[model samples]
Target: MDPQLPAWRIAPEDDVAVALKPLETGETCLGVALRQPIPAGHKFALNALAEGSEVRRYRAPIGIATRPIAPGEHVHGHNLRTALSGELAYRFAAVAKATPVRDKGHRFDGYVRADGGVGTRNELWILPTVGCVGRLGERLAREAERRAGEALASGAIDGVHAFNHPFGCSQLGADLDGTAAVLAALAQNPNAGGVLLLGLGCESNQIDALMARIPADRHARIRAVRAQSEHDEFEAGLRAIGDLLAAMARDRRQPVPLSALRLGVKCGGSDAMSGLTANPLIGRMADAVTQAGGSAILTEIPEMFGAEKLLLERCENEDVFDRLTAMVNGFKRYFLAHGEPVSENPSPGNIAGGITTLEEKSLGAVQKGGVATVADVIGYGERTTRGGLTILEAPGNDAVSTTALAAAGATVTLFSTGRGTPLGSPVPTVKIASNAALATAKRNWIDFDAGTVLTDGIDAASDALLARIVAIASGERTRNETNDERAIGIWKRGVTL
Candidate 1:
């Protein structure tokens, strides 16, 4: 980490060093002069690479060299190809657990819910059961906001939002079920102190059916309206919002243990520095949260292609291991079922940002889970009932996975990006920039500069990150919240009727 050095070898055994800055042909890294210009965040060979030999980064094979590469030569998609293939059977290897630190842990101010869950924000949410009534739900929310301006200014409730999706109607079987599951899960999120479920009675996803999906105990906090059946749908929706707000007016924040915290760790728009900086830094925060007897949810199943073993080996038990194994394979099957290769990843942006293969991207991506033992693997839109690291089943898309995280009860989500993205989830999303340049350039979108870890080190950076998370939990708005970039994306995997 010498300030004078412009390249970083992530591990002592790594065959490549990531360019810390743009370098010319004459610049030396690892005692090898660059053979070509290397962009910042790009990788360069530290030693001669033989054709068909494995190339390593993060001390693991990222891909196979397509041709012989001289030392200091740029390593990229042109010469490196992913070695990933079809999924294989996995055996469970139990990892030792860290003793819970609940005897002493961090605390945050949150709203305690009737179900014993804690809310990072006492916000009111409107969920439309069908797309037909989606705009109606928005109108209701806006009217509610207009009427509650005084209470909003007084912090009676956090800002209100209507989460509307397009596939509630004509979605059959699993697709319809998926829609209902995420919406129900959203209602269950403690962040939604009050919820208004607006529905058009004629839709396939009826208010009655969706209501049945929710727990009976949570019914009191969530009010529903059948827009088609009501004589005046708008008035009925407004009345429902008023009723929910009345109940929330008495809600307040109280000190809660970290065990009450459920964190969702995600990364998008990643670069080489993502692994070296942001992801590992978030990993520190993940381990800290789990060590304190809290919960951390990790998703983006496809990204786990080459590096899933990092999690499989850490499963708390054989059952957890088996479930995670199934989850990974199922996703691969999903890709193949659609005539797509499981190895098709590390998007164009990823390549431009120095990631050459799905394997390399995954190795970096999974770092966000830190080193915590896998406690459980939950299905998409399911809540994290376990109190350590839980893996949720979801895709690698930023929108879909972050929505799954929030639906799974993540009061706050930690999103790391190196290429930069303004996307935010239903919950408060704290964006950590992988490099200082992106952080500086997108101040409005970036929350923390994890790039500092390259200079300041991870220990301090992680502690600072956890503190920032606690503050965010205590009602401090994230960059996403301040910029109003919050939204939800339901996973639509089934056929439309």
Candidate 2:
């Protein structure tokens, strides 16, 4: 056993201690001797727990022990049961205030768009307004890439890719509005120097309607082509987009302050180690960014089921709290409408990785928020204004949640995983691994390792994570982004065309 191992007990009422590493049965740690062998990335009871005693983490009750658990013995599915449903306590003023954190005066090298928004990478985008024009957008993007390479040789543009999708048409209500909002937001994204909008003339979502909401100055960088207006002329659309891409290639990156950044932090393929290390370490990074007066967005509201109360307490006011609570309840209602209880959540992979209940998963999910005050709450595709730490309502599906975050204007994203995932998004995503073995095995995919927090001293682990986030945000090439390889997926709750 490493003598320098650090232990983290998220709650004062926690019954278990997360072992930073593998501990032998007789190893002594922090003056407390291990009563049984504990594996790295697993839990060990810190004190004897009577049957039915609550198990806590993140300072919140996660579940109850089905039987007595001796100190140092593993506390998992075999001995733990899902927490009983009850009214949650929301005591903002009652909880002790945390120590204030200061910013280190750091900033990322990014593109300062004309509108004061900062972009980590500059690219030309092509968007399809409806499924009917998906192929048109794809062709245009391919054409732009082919033509832009001559100037790309001069480093005029990073890359040109058409973001083609199939759900812009045949939608209604919030769904139709959401599709339009995502495309409009993408067009306005600072990362995009230029945008080409391809629309089928008869689609439910029209370019003119979307442009009405967006400012002309920003829309000036965009060119729109309606396939029907041009008699379904794919070649004409490609030529028009090609001309725009040439003009956009001239845009360049400029030095910017940290405050110009809006980031999205999330986790997927989660396991036990996630809550123990990478999640909290990223939480530290989230705190640093928020302290710098930058924005950090935490989404995947479904993944936040049992942990809503923790977020409510941190909300700046009642409105933000109400918005967040309503979103949580909405998800529950949505799931219940389908005749499924929200309690039977967490994918099979999550349980196999040692998370036994949704309560446990929710506790771990909130760690990505760090200790920051919940500044505000926003809905899907809503512009983020009140900055600090804001929560967005969206599902836990990797693509869907990431899509919503990117649409809300996150310039960069921190995606953590334990069982390992290959998903990526349009924004620059820095993949943080939950354990060292996965980080080493998939270095080609993962950008950083949060497992170090469990292996090395906590401070060292956190500092390492901070450094990596800083580097990635500064236009440095993360392992995934460097290859120009990405995992583009969307979480579709409605029917697909």
Candidate 3:
């Protein structure tokens, strides 16, 4: 097979196949003549389809034909229509067993935590207990950074970041509960060595209540300060947070087993090159990480629209497969409930970059999950219990997805892009660009240039990507952090005030 050709057919039922490389008009493939130019990562019909017929990829129905599509015709959003399928109702009765592969038991230099989970980065985190105190938290973090030099140089702290949010104080019902849950999860995230909870004395969401929500065993590592009780002494809050940061800097990375590593994979601003270069390469890297006995997670429910079945077959057991199907159906319900079609996803940027349908986009998106068996499926903001490969329900929005990844206990992240973005998370995000041009153009932000996969052999490119993942896990700073693109976003399913 040509290095650019897709090595696997994700689904056995599909009559369309994705181009692993950029195939121009008239190109011969699988004994069929191309009817139109097909960009890499896009799909072409393997057989003619009458209007209303199913358009399949990854061996599942991605959409319905809007018009007659001749064999070799480009299959995309324009000629396809979103159609909800019965497979979405599929369910598994029990969870799957973990694959019986031997544990690699490798180790990376990381933060050794008392809880047993390893951290890729160690820093003091100051969280706004409520939205009202968000600014104060930010100020304290900035001050701590300035006073301590870089969090590394002063040997007191490497950095301080305020996890500010609009959802903290004024919300009620599920909204408030969700906010508190996510906040507490961030506080317990292994990436932080210590945390300072900054609260507004009068907010509806109290620091003490939030503290009670956290596990008592982890509570000792965190401290809280309220501004309203201090009689206008905001300076005291600043000093308290800053001092904790300095103390946190004294901690250092230690040798930790690879099983302790929890990694998150995400992508945004996708293009044709997205699936071809960055995503698939990251998928292979995910496999490597799992092989080393570490954890790798893939989420963003909407992006999983078309490739849900491929994931189902890979589920370790029937229960996981059921959970995976339910999650996909739930996301579709959410979209329809909002008076929108599920296919309305695959942003305009995707179309311009050669992705013509949600199915094509999804087939490529799930590549980040790699070939590993699905160990578990988790709800939004839930902690992953299984280790080999866990799938968390999340959105494709960069910040929300990264935030969910963090809440799921990922210590580091891998983000791919083709249209370019400056998004980063509280955790280190190693940005991988799909093409050489974007990598070089955004050199300061991209941690690795995956475009070489298109020019160099895919195997060689896969090796380079794996090397970068290991390096980042070992504590190398990603460009997003260095460039100060510290983006923090949460997924909101309801109103917030």
Provide the TM-score for each candidate, comma-separated.
0.98, 0.90, 0.88
Better of 2 and 3 by TM-score: 2
Highest TM-score model number: 1
lDDT, candidates in the order shown: 0.90, 0.76, 0.77
The residue-level lDDT of candidate 1 at 118 comes to: 95
Q: For candidate 2, write residues 36-143 as lDDT tens digits.
A: 776665677788889998887767777889999877677778898877343333444433243466666776778777777788877777778887878777777777
**Local error of candidate 1 at 87, Å?**
1.4
Judged by lDDT against the true structure, how good is candidate 3?
A: 0.77
Indicate whether candidate 1 or candidate 2 has the larger lDDT. 1
Ranking by lDDT: 1, 3, 2
What lDDT does model 1 reach? 0.90
What is the alpha-carbon lDDT for the whole of candidate 2? 0.76
In model 2, residue pairs whose N, Cα or C atoms come closer than 3 Å (at least 3 residues apart or on different chains), thus clashing, are 400-491
Task: Give candidate 1 misplaced runs (Cα > 4 Å).
Answer: 96-104
Residues 150-182 of candidate 3 have per-residue lDDT tens digits of 655743344677877776766777767777777
TM-score-best of 1 and 3: 1
